[model samples]
Target: MNKSTFNTASAIALAAAALAGPAVAQQATAVEEVIVTAQRSSQNLQQVPLAVTGYSGAFLERSKIEDFNDLRTRTPSLTFEQFAPGQPRYTIRGIGGGGGVAVFVDDVYMGQPSMSSVEFVDLERVEVLRGPQGTLFGRNATGGAIAFFTEKPGSDYRVKAKATVGNYDLKSVSALISGPVSDVLSAKISVIAREHSGYAFNETTGRDIEDETLAAARAALRFRPNDDWDIQLNIDGSTRRGTAPWWDLMIEAPKSAGKSNPEPRRGRNHTDDGYADIDNAGVSLNANWDSPIGTFTSITAFRNTQSHNRANTTGLLVAPLSDVANRRVNFHTLFIQQADQKAEQFSQELRLAADLGDRFKWIGGLYYYQDDGVANRLTDYRFYGFGPTPVDGRYAYASTNETKAFAAFMSGTFALTEQLKLQAGIRWSHDEKDHTTVASGKNFSGFRDGGVSVPGYSAASSADWSAWTPTASINYQVTPDVFVYGTISRGFKSGGFSDGDSEKQSILRPFNPEFVWNYETGARTEWFDRRLRVNATAFYMDYTDLQVSVFTQLAPNLPAVLVSGNAGKAKIKGFELEWNAVPIEGLNLYGNYTRTESEISALISGANNLAGKKIPRAPENKFFMGASLARDFGGMTATGRVDYTYQSDYFSSINNVPSERVLAQENWDAGLTMGPAGGAWSVEVWGKNLANELHVVSISDILGDAFANYAPPRTYGVTLSYRH
Candidate 1:
């Protein structure tokens, strides 16, 4: 259905329920309480004014959610796409990019989107907050924020282990141990190892197009000298090596473009070498102190990460790029590329929370972060009869980025009456970034004329920016079981230098910050003796100075470069609904839906007139529903669950090219578990993508060729778990 229809349906459903609440009310078992920290404080989900979706560690395991990609179907208004392993793109209400969302592990921020896509093992809970969160989450949170809380050391000793064997030769083992070391100390450790021979079969190479090997470990130590203070230290590391799926040339090139139209095939590749490797490690320290006036918290962290990727640049083209005439060189021939990147980051945060009597509560914090990174790329066309010299089709590019940031934030809530409350928060942040780049190449690719006269070029640039965002919210309890709230908040995303182009495009300097003002209203209700819970939220956002990449050629007779700038304006609106019911004992049902509409109102002068184009990756309609049944059989217990998800079509690029869109698709997954009552072990059998549907999750159009990545096929697995 269209956006209007979807939105109307949502409104009618919510309004009807509110009007007929008493008629539908009945006696039943109450649902469990859901607690969240989306507001920087622990509160019942129903009492919070924000839109958040939370999944507990137990829920995650039962749902077979191994990573963020698998978590998408269980949540509303969330989607993921990728060009390669570890290079993930997430969209929320059509407002996502490099500077849209922020990810946090415990209190430590992961600076890059790719870094946040790691496996979600050993997590206590995962929370997703929708809308701009700049007032409290600092920079780069225009769309929203995702927070992952890891399991902490416990007061008692415990041991847990799990193993799984799945289709495509997939095998994994994970273990966790926790124990008390002394009177005042406790420690916990978790480790996981997994390997998968991917499902993508290559037609030309006779090999699997994608495969993975992964290992991760985390250890935590906690010290509690007394009731007034505590400290925790965490160390985590992970390594991944994989052969990423090869791209499919979907839409054929036009004959008028002087290129042959090759048929598209799934999991087929002509490239001989394509692989990715990544390593990440981090350390975090947290301390908490309680005083008569307030509670103080400090979080300090440092991280190191590195990655390498190798691929064929021309593998998707039908014919080699060359000239059979004058130079006897084919520019369309094989072009292999390699990229390497390494980064280091450090962050510190201090926060104080105070409870002034029972009517007033406040929180304030200060944060600082630093990042340094370098990336280098090399492209070679020697196999296409070209030498290693720049004039002979060899190219190299290198870039470095250094960033420093600081912020201060404060928030307070006041109970004006027994049923009404007022909340206000504001944050001020400053950011500085330095960028340097060097490029060396002959310029033999594609141009009406010979490449530039220079064999090498270099450029350096820097930028400093600051922003102040404020939030105001009002909430009122209509009844003991229902509440209504409204909020107006501003969010900001810090801009940085572009990395898509070489020094030849010096005009692609530093970009400016992007900002959004969000206005939202919502209602949370628990009816039928608390057996049914429903929450609905509607939001309107005004976005300005949006950072967008424009393809352009800085000089005549040269190829185009992707230069980013704050050059767009847009309007975004959406509605979300979440509902759960436990109408009968031993049975539970839960579902969520979202309707979103986004329009690009303006763009830069030289860019295409995309004023009416739909935002990329934002589907007009998304829905999910699931049911679980549990029962006792003598001395044993059995549980079964099934879920279905549906999403509308969406474009992958801001250009709104027809070839870069993914069609609507639906997916199904189910699981069954069995274990003896009071036993320490259980077994689960699960299947995902049961329908074996083939769909594209991402697509791109480059040089008149349409390339895309497909979602995984059907897979089934069995897992065994034991805990003590």
Candidate 2:
């Protein structure tokens, strides 16, 4: 359907619901209340002055939100995409890039994007905080933050298991067991395994590509020696192996070098299959002590990850072949790239919180973090079809990076009167980064004299930066069922060097940090005797020193390299509306809408004049609506749910080229579940992307050729679950 028609329909549905809500409200029940920790403390969702979306574990399971990608579909003003397999990126409110948004699991920061694709297993809830979160988070959270809270070990013994079978030979199994080991000790364990057949056809191998196999497990131990202190330890690990999706060439290359494919879910490769393998593991220790003065908390964590990938740079099914010296050569076979990367991080955090009577409360913390990583890559552009030895045009590089950071933050709230409050926060952060690289190449094409040999060279660079971010807000309780708040906050992201390029100049040049100031006002209200809850927010951001990545050639004869640079300035304004209601018994409804506008106001000299261009991955309009109904029949309960989502068109790059635009898309999902009331067993039948819409998630322009990656297609499954 067209945009106009879809919007009109959405408006009508919303209006009808609003008109009918009060008439039936006398019989409706009160909506359930949700508690969140968006501000580092537990508070009612409706009372928190920030814009956050929360989903309970039960809701997630009912909606079949199995992964991070699925969660993004239900959150307003949030977008997720992958440039390549194992590389995940998130954008919120038109602000995103490397490290723009941060992810946390049980308060432990995740420093690597490769770990962002974790499965949702045994989670208590997931919270998505929109806008800047620099003061409390104190990291690279210029856009926002996503936090996952896992289920903790309980004193009672319990067991839960679930199994799923779906189309394309999909199979998944997950289990969780929790119990008390002793009077003062409790433990829990959770494990999951999933495998699925490929969705894209591979004609060359006569086998499907983009298949996946994954396994993950988590173990936890909690010790409560006495009422004054408690300690908890958690260990987790995961592994993934998958055939990477082959890029679809959207534009034909010159001289028939690469073939174009209009189909998004089809692949044709003349050479080896593209694939990715990733492994990640982490451990964390948390301790809490209650003192006469206040409460003290400490968190220590360590994580490590490794990944390897192989991809066909030129997605070509066929190419012109020629014979030189009685040897057959095909140029398409020469386009290949491989990379290996490893990273590890360690962090420590200490916090103290206290309540000064009932009028004032405060929290303060100190954080220290360190990380090290290395990456190796090889790119070949020579015909290897004739023999084992290639002619020329080969490049290889190894790069290493290290970082150490320290931060101190404090936040507090003071009640001025019975209905008015003031809140303020500040964070001071210091970061040091070091980078080194060794690169070498031979017989590069388009260089002087048709070829040039690059000797092995090493480069090193180091830099340090510091920033102070702060926030201030005022909240007023208009009534027992209404709240209004206004806030001004600043966010900062650290500066770093670019190591993707083989050139020394690009490796040594460090980009500046990015900063943004956000001004937002929001209102939360409940009507119809608490049966309906509606929250609305309007925000404007003054963004500066945006770090952008661009591929460019230093000189006419040099190869193009990816580099990080700072853009002049930009402006972003947006608004969001979220509502939840139970207009009648046995029925629940929820919906959200987001409207955003982002434009670059200035550009660096010598760069393309993109002052009025839209930011990449920032869609203008997004909407989601879902409904569920439950009924009792013959001592059993039956529940049915349906959801719909729409996303407007967006560009993949800052250049805003037509070929790089991702078209507007819509999706639908549904599920039906049945089980005995208060029973131990249940069954659910579910379907996702029921309409089988083909939408592009990412696009890249390489040497005048555009390649695109498509989202997953239709899938249906059945799940059986048991609890004790």
Top candidate, metric lDDT: 2
Q: In terms of TM-score, how similar is model 1 to the real structure? A: 0.89
Model 1, span 291-347: residue lDDT tens: 888999999999998888886544444334456555543433344668888989999
In model 1, the Cα lDDT at residue 719 comes to 86
Please give the lDDT score at residue 517 for candidate 2: 95
Candidate 1 positional error at 254, Å: 3.0
lDDT of each: 0.77, 0.81
Q: Per-residue alpha-carbon lDDT of model 2 for 555-635, expressed as tens digits?
A: 443324556788779899999999989988878899899999999999652356879988889999999999988887897
